[model samples]
Target: MGSIVLTHLKSAWHVDQAILDDEEKIVVLRFGKTTDAAVMAMDEHLSKIADRVQNFASIYVVDNKEVPDFNAMYELYDACTVMFFFRNKHILVDCGTGNNNKINFSIADKQDLIDIIEVVYRGARKGKGLVVSPKDYATQMKY
Candidate 1:
């Protein structure tokens, strides 16, 4: 005889606090305005815990003004400014554009579009929870 059992699987969404708390290194990609003050502030904060943080943490500022092709700015970092963070496993990406509302959507400027990159990066790194089929049939059948 063949029988089928169905179980409910709950998925939880959470920020990987460990990723930030235990991070030994942090890399920031500053484009557009490229604020030195912010960089200095972050550096100062990180320096306090430098002893506990054992990895290499550095900030790279890439001014979009220097780039010959503005459109290529997105491509500069894998179609997103935050890609560097993913590539280097950094905790955050501060693109110099203050907040989402501050961004000028009317313009396709690199600075304005940086937020899009940030959003995509945030979404990929911390996915929203959704109920889906389990990888193992036995686990699914048990619920």
Candidate 2:
């Protein structure tokens, strides 16, 4: 249900424009296929918080197979990858997952996702290229 509502970047140009054009809000892009389970799960979390974070972030999902333009550049090799951008600059978060380049896993909790986006928004507004995630994914106890 959530995945059905989130906006998707269908082309390479749309993907570039989404990052390049949105000047005020952080552009959050989820790279993967909508048909994939992990990507759909991530989209659920994202869409759940879409309205809540609209003041500072704009969420968009892109199908890697369809766009394919940013896959190699961003090293998108996971089932689902969530990336952030601010003022046309890529925003990196230290999720403690060894890979700060992008969130390469499905965040189980939506609050966890909100925390990350808030951290990114605050840090990017201050002109910081990278920011530490609120919770360390590497250390969080799994249920």
Q: Best candidate, lDDT-wise?
A: 2
Error of 2 at 124 (Å): 0.3
Local accuracy by lDDT, each model: 0.30, 0.88
Predictions: Cα RMSD each:
21.2, 2.0
Pairs with backbone N, CA or C atoms under 3 Å apart (clashes), candidate 1 = 7-143
Pairs clashing in candidate 2?
Answer: none
Q: After superposition, how far is residue 77 of candidate 1 from its true place, in Å?
A: 15
lDDT for 90 (candidate 1): 33
lDDT tens digits, residues 16-113, model 1?
23223323333333333223443233233333433332234333334344542432524433212322343334332223333211111122233323
Residues forming the 10-long window of minimal summed lDDT in candidate 2: 134-143
Could you tell me the lDDT of residue 77 within candidate 1?
A: 30
Q: Model 1: what TM-score? A: 0.25
Error of 2 at 17 (Å): 0.6
- Candidate 2's TM-score reads 0.94
